[model samples]
Each structure stands twice: as C-alpha cells, then as structure tokens.
Target chain A: MLNLRPCTLTWLVLVSLTLMALAIGQAGLAGWGILALLLVSTFVKTWLVAEYFMGLRRVALRWRLIMAAYLVLVLSGIALAWWLAARAAA
Target chain B: MIWIFIYAELLVFGILFLAYAFARSRNVVLFNASQLELNRTAGAVNTLVLITSSYFVVRAVAAIRADRAEACARWLLAAVGLGGVFVVVKLSEFAAKSAAGIGLSTNTFYMFYWSMTFFHFMHVLLGMVILLAVWWKARQGAYSASEHTGVETGASYWHMVDLVWIILFPLVYVMR
Candidate 1:
C-alpha cells in the first residue's frame, strides 16, 4: 500500500524546488517575515518528505499525527529560538 | 521494525536541530556573521540533489511493487549516483571552507555546521551502502511485487537522510 502515484511524487519534487527558490530569493533580506517564511518552507518540505517519499502516506492516522506533531515541535523550537535572539538583539 | 529506527533517527536529528537553534540564540551576531561565509549555492544544489535522489528512490520502490526487478535495480543505482553527486558537492563546499582556514574551532556557528553536516554526511554514506546491498539482491531476483520489503526498508532510510537535509538546508543556510 506504499505505492505513491507518479504524479504525486513529481508534484512534491516541484513543490520542494519552488520552496528552495523562495528561500534563496529571501536569503539576503533581514526581517522576521523572511525568517518565518524560510522556517515555514522547512516545515512543509519536511512534512512532504515524511509523508510521501518515506512512504508514510497511507499509514495509520496516529503515526501521521505523531510525525506531524514532532515536526511542529522541532520547527517551533527553532523559530522560538530565532525570535528570542531577535528580541534580545533589539 | 525499520519504521521504529527511522522515527528514532528523526528524534535524534530533531534534538540536534534544536541544539543548533539554542546555540544560535546565544550569539545571534556571531551566528549570522558566520552564516554569511557558508556556500549557500552548494548547499542549495545539494538540497536539490538529495530531493531528486529521494524521487529516484520512490521510483525504485514503485518498480519493485510492479515486480520489475531490473528496473528497480536501475532506479536504485540512479539514486546512488545522485548520492555521489551530493558527496562531491558537499566535499567541494567543505574544501572551500577549509582552504579559507575554517575548522571546527573557527567559531561556535562553524562548529555546529561542521559537526551536524558531517553527521548527516555519514548517514548518506551508510544509506548508499544499504542501497548497494539492496540493488545487488534486487538484481539477483531476491524480491518481487509481493515480497520487496528489503527495497522498502532501504528506501525508507534513504528518505530519512534526505528529510534531515531538507530541514537542515533552510535552518542552517538560509534562515537568519
């Protein structure tokens, strides 16, 4: 049941490349907005990898939920650290 | 279960990523300045390469599901070839940094960068080994559409390596 459709896999690849482009475009900009955007892209790409490429797409819903929550926790930790750093510098 | 090991690996990398964030928070200026010196283009290219390899890996697994052993082996080999590309790109990036006299002791930021990426680099190597073994077995008709768990297991680990890099690229290279 781990048969991911070809179209879906191709679409995920395109989405990831587009996200990379967005990150590169915003790399030199200095602002919370840019930072948040990069972090969100990381989140989305991570989820796509976990769900599709890792063949977790049709697993038990609980497993999917757990991975999603763990992802949120990790990204949120990084984001919170960045926010705190910015505030301290301010 | 391989799935358990996969999740465990994710948890480990998650902690390391947070540790990086915590370190960055302490000296934001140092982290930002050091980040400016990294080879972002190489990092980006490696990201694309890893994701492409993951796609190839998916194709390999799909091939096995369809009972196409030779096609599956070919796809796995293709993924391994992409992994080689990632190694070349990453080594060049590392060599460039070293040519400038950068090392683990260069700064706190570089320390994290070197150690974390190197750790992930090791995983990539290990994943390729697993893939090579899988490819050999696959070519020998060791698996079929109904019993290709070996292919799935190898692909799972490779994807885990790819997944870590996906989060790592933006977190370390692009985010400010």
Candidate 2:
C-alpha cells in the first residue's frame, strides 16, 4: 500500500527524471537540441512537483494554471535567451 | 498567507533565473566554462535529497490526515534530517569553491551562482525551521485529522523550496 501511494509514485518518477537530467549534463552534449530536451525534461519535473507534491492537482483550476504559466514563461525566456546566443555566435 | 508567500518567493526566483539566463546569453562562452567547474554531482545529489525530503513531508501530511500524530512527527523529523544533509553538502561544496579562491566577484557566472544558490540555501534553512515547528506541534498532538492546517502549510512551503531547486539545478549546473 505504501508503494501504491501517489506521492510515492511521484517521487519515483522525479528521481528517475533527475538521474536522466544528470546523465544529460554529464554527457557533454551541446547545441540547441540538447538544451531543448533538457528544458522539456525540466518542465515535466517541475510540473510533477507542482501537481503532485504541492497538491495543486486537487486545487482549483486557476491555481494550477498559474503554476503552469510560471513554468512556461520562465522556460521560454531561457530558451529564447539561449537561442539568441546561438544565433549571435553563428 | 503561505500561498501568498509562495507566490512572492516564486516571483523573486523567477526574476533571478531570467536574469541569470540573460547574463549567460551575453557571455555564453564564459558561462559555459564556469559552469563546468561546478560539482554537478553535488547539485544532483542535493536535488535528490530535497525531493526525498519533500516526499517525507507528503507522508507526514498523510499521517496527520489519518490521525497518526506520532507518525506525522516521525516523518517530519526524517524530512528535517534530510534537510541537514542538504545543508552539509551545500556548505562543503561552497567551502571547496572558496578553497579554490572562488568568490562572488570571480565572474558573472560565479556571481549568479553564489547569489542564487545562497539565496535558495537560506530558504532551505527557513523551511527546515518551519517543518520543525510543525513537527513540534505534531509531537504534542496538536494536529488532528480534522485540523491539520499547520502541517499542510509547512508542507506547502517545503515543497516550494524543492520546486525552486528543480529549476535552479538544471539552469545553473546542468543546462550549459
């Protein structure tokens, strides 16, 4: 029953994702493609934390959307910044 | 009140993150090189530690909801124990950097690195305090299944601390 809990499941996924991100970092991969993948992974991890660990899933829709917007806006800003840097280097 | 604080905290961190991204963009080469000097393993381990502590908090909440005061206190204690691990690991990491002669003024990357992470470190300390207070109350059997707002509030705050690190780890240590 402990293993079947939602929080337990969420923790497992979060750990696996953290390891995946660590591996990506250690791989020394570069370029926009790797960055995009990392950002996507980040988005997923943050969303999981918000939805499950934070218990936003049981809250009002507006609250969940607010969290979503925060993630999107910040990640988009990062992606855009990196994209501009890449373009400038090119 | 906790929700408002969470929103305000998130806003502050978001600005710092965006500022970091902007600064990194301006000097991508230097940022990338400086990032390579950071101990990614430490950052990753801290991530796991925080996440696990968060899980412990979730269990604490569950225990309280089930009217298990002793179990709730035990879980919160476990969470705080992990928080101690984070502080020790982070301090060692900082000490190692200091030993290598790194300071806030070392470079743009180090500046952001020191400022942002130290800021997050303070929050972790505060979150641990909040958890301890809630834990104390739980130990006294002050929170019941019908009235456990304190536990929930503290859990929320702890989760926010973890949430910030989820972004910070990737942005600072990994996403070079």
Candidate 3:
C-alpha cells in the first residue's frame, strides 16, 4: 500500500511479458501443459490488475469476500470449460 | 472490492480466451494463415495508448482526492482522448482488413479475431461513455476529496480493459 504506484506499474509489466509469452508460446507449445501455463499466468495478471490498479485494496472485508466468492464461480466456469474442451477433443 | 470485481470479470473473459485458444489449437493451419493479415502496428500502438490512459486516470483519481478538480478533469480528458484514439484506430484497422477481404467469414482465426476485438471494442466504447459522464460530473463539482469513488471506479474499469488488450494484442497479432 505504501508503494502502490510502482507496484501497479510492475503489475502492468508482468502482464505485458505474460501476454508476449502467451502470444509466442501459442504456435510453439502444445498439449494441455501449455494451456495450463497460459491459464495460470493469465490468472496472475488479472489478480494484480484487480488488486492494485483497480483500487480494490481499500475496500472493506465483505466486499473483498464477495469478490472472492465471485472468483469461486469463475473457477467453476473454467472447470466447466475445460470439461467441454475435453469433450470436444474426444 | 472493485478491484476484486474487476478480477472476477477478468476470470470470465479469461475462460472465453482459453476457449478461443483451445479452438485455435485444433485448427492450426487455418488460423495461422488467417492471422497473417493483421496489422501488427495498430495493435502495438493501441497497447501503448491504453497503458498511458491507465496512468492518466490514476492521476485523475489522485487529483480528485486532492481537491484539484481542474487537474483531475484534464487527466480524465487525457484518458478519454486515448480511448477515442483506440476506437478510431481499431475501426480503421478493421476497415483495412476488410478491404483486403478479411471478414468474419474469412476463417476461424478471423472469426475469433473480429469477435474478440468487436467485443473488446464495445468495452472500450463503454469506458469512453463512463469517462465522459465522469467528466461531466467533475465539471459539476460532483467529486472531491472525500467522495470521488466515481473516478476511481471508472479508472478501474478502464485499466481492466487495457489489461485485456495487453493479452489480446499479442495473442491475435503476434503468436503465430
């Protein structure tokens, strides 16, 4: 919190790198491993954006918990998507 | 809370993005050939603009909190201006691609490209609308040292859009 400014910029830079990696890795990497990597990196970038850049850091506990709850639903959606992808592959 | 909400929104988009990539992975040749037609420069410039806009909006929030409405408005306008540039550049790029015969029906790659960008473009448009509304509110002195969540919240949405673009740009423009 004391160093919010730099932290936000650093978060931005991390997203940039991950974006480039996803972009480049798309053609070169294959199978479930690469896809998993992309998902985790994307999650990290989104987390930073939500925490630092969006000013959610100052909100109360309930709101934070609500956000976490929403994230659980999101994770559920992702799991469903992965299942669908597997079904498609089959 | 707002940031967390933004993350939640991102998770939804992230799933969609994974879906797109997964689809693309299954059609390597078609997507690859289709991706070649994109104008990389447009994507790159848009990335720079959005990041700069995020920084300006951050300043806007700071300015409003400090009771500097005039400075806040200026930064707000700067953010909005970059957003406008983003739309104009995106449309023109789309037009150029269309002229080259790349439309939604072009291929799976283009379907994803157009769909993703058009969807993201709507978000950008929404951000611009919110910024204008905030500017109007600022002009009316609706925000100040203690009650400027409007600007802060708007900035949050704007930053999230830029973050999406950071990933979308490289994914659609460069990865192939």
Best by DockQ: 2
For candidate 1, list the clashing residue pairs, or say none: none
Off by over 4 Å in 3: A1-45, A60-90, B1-12
Worst 10 residues of 3 chain B by lDDT: B167-176
Off by over 4 Å in 1: A1-27
C-alpha-based local distance difference test score of model 2: 0.94
Encode model 3's per-residue lDDT on A1-90: one tens digit a residue.
355575557546664755465455444554456545644554565455556666656777766565555544544444455555556657
The segments of candidate 2 whose C-alpha lies over 4 angstroms from its true place after superposition are A1-3
- Native-referenced TM-scores of chain A, all candidate models: 0.71, 0.90, 0.63
Q: DockQ of all candidates, in order?
A: 0.54, 0.84, 0.18
Candidate 2 at residue A53, lDDT?
Answer: 86
Error of 2 at A35 (Å): 1.1
Looking at model 2, residue B61 earns an lDDT score of 92
Lowest lDDT 10-residue stretch of candidate 1 chain A: A18-27
Question: Count of backbone clashes for each model?
Answer: 0, 0, 0
lDDT per residue, candidate 3, B56-164, as tens digits? 8878888998999989999999989999999999999989988888888877778889888998999999999999899889989999999998888888889889778
Q: Which docking class does model 2 fall in?
A: high
lDDT of 1 by residue, A1-90 (tens): 768575366546645664665456445775777767777777777788887777688788877887898899999999899888878888
